[model samples]
Target: MPKMVFIETDGTRREVDAPLGLSILEVARRHDIDLEGACEGSLACSTCHVVVAPEWYDLLPDAQEDEEDMLDLAFGLTKTSRLGCQIRITPELDGLTVKLPGAK
Candidate 1:
């Protein structure tokens, strides 16, 4: 199992042991973490935007042009930002940490 940390906009943090290959969005939704998936992981909405904790940013693949474009519309954009649906969990991301931006 891969472990992931989610820091909510209200400052609440939760840890979950996720199955491999699950998207970050999937993990969040499974734990009822309140992440909005307006586009249902279709790469059409910025509601699922989240910031990868600095230390773990390099652990995931870079965002693609579509994800990047969507991220540009997200609130509280940061250098470590990524679309949760675009990040597939892997063993290397066992300790991944992410911050949920204030909802738009």
Candidate 2:
């Protein structure tokens, strides 16, 4: 199993196991973290927006155009901003870190 660290808006960090292939959003929701995937994993919304750690951001696959369009609506977009739903936990991301943007 892979693992990941989540940095909350208040600066708290929590680490959790991420089953291979599960999206960051799933791990957050499973652990009761504050992220809100309002559209489930449908990619229809940007409610699961997260800022990937700079070092880890490059390891993720490029975002699709649709996800990019939705990211445009994210509350605090950044160079590493991504839809948590679109990032799967692969072996390369065993210790991934991402920060949850402050609440809208």
Cα lDDT listed for each candidate: 0.90, 0.93
Please give the range of 10 consecutive residues that has the lowest summed lDDT in model 1.
95-104
Provide the clash count, candidate 1.
Answer: 0
Instruction: Give residue 86's error in model 2 in angstroms.
Output: 0.4
Stretches of candidate 1 exceeding 4 Å from the true structure = none
Model 2 clash pairs are none
Evaluated against the true structure, the overall lDDT of model 2 is 0.93
Instruction: Estimate, for each residue in 1-104, the C-alpha lDDT of model 1 and write its tens digit.
Output: 77999998888888998789989999999999988889999999999899889899987888899999999999899999999999998888898999999622
Report the number of the highest-TM-score candidate: 2
Query: lDDT, candidate 2, residue 50?
Result: 96
Clashes of 2: 0
